[model samples]
Target chain A: MTETASLRRAARRYRLEFGGAMAAYALTVLGTSLWIDANPGSSARLPVALLPVIPVVLVVVAAVRFFRSQDELLRRRQVEALAFAFVGTALAVITYGFFETVGFPRLSAWWTWGTMAILWCVGTFVSSRRYG
Target chain B: MKNLLRVLRTERGWSQLDLAEQLGVSRQTVNALETERYDPSLPLAMRIARLFERPVESLFFLDEDAT
Candidate 1:
């Protein structure tokens, strides 16, 4: 029972789920962009913005499950990884948001992909440092 | 970290999983130690040494910087 908390095992499961969700997130963006572009006159702003929320929720859920019933060391390492990702993401988003509010061109469609790339790489580093 | 975990466990004929189970950690932790990717905290290292019936120094050695 206690052996279930192996970091590698937990990390492997999280990676698989995260990868699937990432694919869904990318497809959602591509599919929705195509639909919206085809109907440029349509008003689906709320729905369009909500599209990215799917991956966000999936990641959070996976993170929660990964930490469930674990010992403190493992739990703390997960938290450390999350903290790095969230803090890094917030800084990036706010910087971009500030630029946009000041009339800079918004990032291109592939911008969502950047978050996943950053989170995975940076989160892994943080986890390794904290847990290793 | 330099540890005699593998040696001690081998002497007792215990696999990494067996020792991990005794400590409530993952076999990955054991693997990490064997591979030197991770270093356990002092308490955990001590616990492991005790569990294997060896002195802490016999189980794990410190680098020059550790001192």
Candidate 2:
């Protein structure tokens, strides 16, 4: 198959796998939350809370597979974007941590992941423009 | 690095997309190569040379200042 066809197939597969994994994560989170709420102080609460991580692992696997499928230029772009996101997220979190020490409201650790994800998109866009 | 990619590609009457298709890369990559915004990997450079029926040295060269 042509590179274009192979790329399209990889993209489609990634979308399907990522979408399915996210759906599963959402369902697991909802189920676990409800179960915990209904049975306060249950021994299984810790395990149930961690259940969502399984689907998240699958999502990460799907992402890695998609990255591997891309050509050299695209792989370089992805590496640059990921580097940008990694560094940007670190700086942001550290800055935010300093603010929290100086009377700002404390934030959840989940915000770090959210910030990284947003920066990843921004980095990808910036890298795309750089190449174009 | 400087390359005669644009000149060679136009000489063959191939659009960026057509060349990208032939090279098995995205059109943006082809555009980057033509504009000298990106340098291709050695393998990609070899592939381009093979496709154009030219030696790699004939297709690409260092800028005079770099020599």
Candidate 3:
């Protein structure tokens, strides 16, 4: 198969894996939250609360596989984007940490990941435009 | 870096996507190469040279060399 065909196949596989993982994550989160609320004194509360992490791990694996499937140029772009996201998210979170001490609301740890994801998208867009 | 990518590509009437397909890269990567926005890695440069049947040095050079 041509590179384009191979890339398309990889992309299709990635989409499916990512979609499935995200769906599982959502369901696990919903289920676990409901279970915890219904069984506040349950002995398995900690384990049930962490159930969503399994799908999250799968999502990370899917991402790694997708990254490996990319060509060198795309890989470079991804690296650059990830670096941007890493630094941007770190700075934002650290800055917000100081604000919390001054009276800001405490944010969930998930916000850090969400911020990084948004920054990654922004970085990818900027990098794409730079190359174009 | 300066390169003869655009000239050679146009000479053969190949679109960016066509060359990208030949080079196993995205069309945007081809555009980046042609526009001198991004430099290819050594292996990729060699691949391009092999594809065009040209010496690597002949295909790409420092910008100062153009002057």
What CA root-mean-square deviation does each model show from the true structure? 6.0, 2.4, 2.0
Cα lDDT computed for each candidate against the true fold: 0.73, 0.91, 0.92
lDDT of 2 by residue, A10-48 (tens): 899999999999999999999999999998978988998
What's the i-RMS for candidate 2 in angstroms? 3.4
Worst 10 residues of 1 chain A by lDDT: A1-10
Candidate 2's docking class is acceptable
lDDT of 3 by residue, A10-107 (tens): 89999999999999999999999999999988999999999999999999999999999888778888899999999999999999999999999999
Q: Between which residue pairs do clashes occur in model 3? A: none
Q: Which stretches of candidate 2 lie over 4 Å from their true place?
A: A1-3, B65-67
Runs with alpha carbons beyond 4 Å of true place in candidate 1: A1-68, A71-73, A105-122, A125-132, B65-67
- lDDT tens string, model 1, A1-132? 435446657778888877887888888878877877787877885698579778878977876777774555565566776677777777887889899998999887567567856785788776867445
Comparing 2 with 3 on lDDT, the higher-scoring candidate is 3
lDDT, model 2: 0.91
Tell me, by lDDT, which candidate is best. Answer: 3
Better of 1 and 3 by DockQ: 3
Q: What lDDT score goes with residue A126 in model 1? A: 69
TM-scores, all models, native as reference: 0.55, 0.91, 0.93
- Please say which candidate is ahead in lDDT: 1 or 2: 2
